[model samples]
Target: MNKKQETKYELILNAAFEQMKEKGFEKASISQIVKRAGVAQGTFYLYFDSKGAIVPAIAERILEEQLGLIKSEVKENDSIDRIIDVLIEQTFKLTDRNKEVIKFCYSGIAYYDSFQRWEDIYRPYYLWLEKKLEKAITTKEIAQRKSISHQAIFIIGLIEQSAENYFLTDEPKKDEELNLYKQDLYHFIKRAIS
Candidate 1:
């Protein structure tokens, strides 16, 4: 796409992101997205077929941002425990910072098949973690296991669910209680895998 087209494309996506944040994926409408984008409705159709069609793009953007934050926190020589800590910390930080997007994605899963495309968007993170776990298992850093795929999936689910529960939930939590929960979560996962 040329510069002008690129600008319009970004405007639509950014507008869609904002709409999804405010109204949620299921309720966020194409017309609102186009209006917020300052583009004609026809322009939206040029880029996306429906509101649902935009979800995979949003999911990809959100996951990429989270992965970037996680990668930034880890050093080349970090130990498995340290990496896990960084992962947890970064995951919580991202969820807290982008709570609306996280909530939209989670809630969208209940309503939109496009939301299930997360597995594809998350493939890189999954493979990266799987490779790390495979090495750990081989070196006996984590317990030797034949089911690395299962283990990797468990780890992903653990982080995603825990972060959503603690950081993205509407439920109120006191600072002290939240800290304790985070510590407990860290220890629980550490013990489970290490």
Candidate 2:
């Protein structure tokens, strides 16, 4: 896609994201998204076949943003503790900001066969974590795992689930409580990998 196409694509995506967040994947309509995007309905069809088709695209955009943040904030030479702290902090903030979109993408992807590309969308983020694990293992910073791939997935599952539970469910936490939770999570992950 060229620059204009990219802009229109993003507009449609942002519109879809807002609509999905507000009305959910089941209720958000293609008409609503296109109308909100100020684009022709045909324009949306040019980018996505159906409402469900947008899920992986949304997931890709969100994960790509998160990966960018991770790469910029977490240094290669950072110690394990620093790495954990940064990951937890950054993941929590991202989850807090985009919890609804995250929730929508998780559910929305399941209904579309094309969303099988979900794993492909997430592969880069997973590979980045895997590389971190490999480096840690080589430096004796974390225990050697039989499969670094599984280890990376486990770490991501833990962090994402915990963030969802903490930020997306129940009552909100105070700053001190949130800090304690982060500390406990950091220690839990540290011990598990060590």
The residue pairs that clash in candidate 2, if any, are: none
| lDDT to native, each model | 0.81, 0.88
My TM-score estimates for the predictions, one after another, are 0.88, 0.91
lDDT of 1 by residue, 122-163 (tens): 888888788878777766788977787877778877887898
Backbone clashes in candidate 1 total 0
Q: What's the CA RMSD of model 1 in angstroms?
A: 2.1
Residues 1-194, candidate 2: write the lDDT tens digits.
89999999999999998999899888999999999999999999998888989999998888888888888988879876787777788889999999888888878887887555987887888898898889988899888889999988888879878988998886956889988998899999998999
Cα RMSD for candidates in order = 2.1, 1.8
* TM-score of structure candidate 2: 0.91
Best by lDDT: 2
User: For model 1, what is the error of residue 87's alpha carbon versus the real structure, in angstroms, after optimal superposition?
Assistant: 1.3
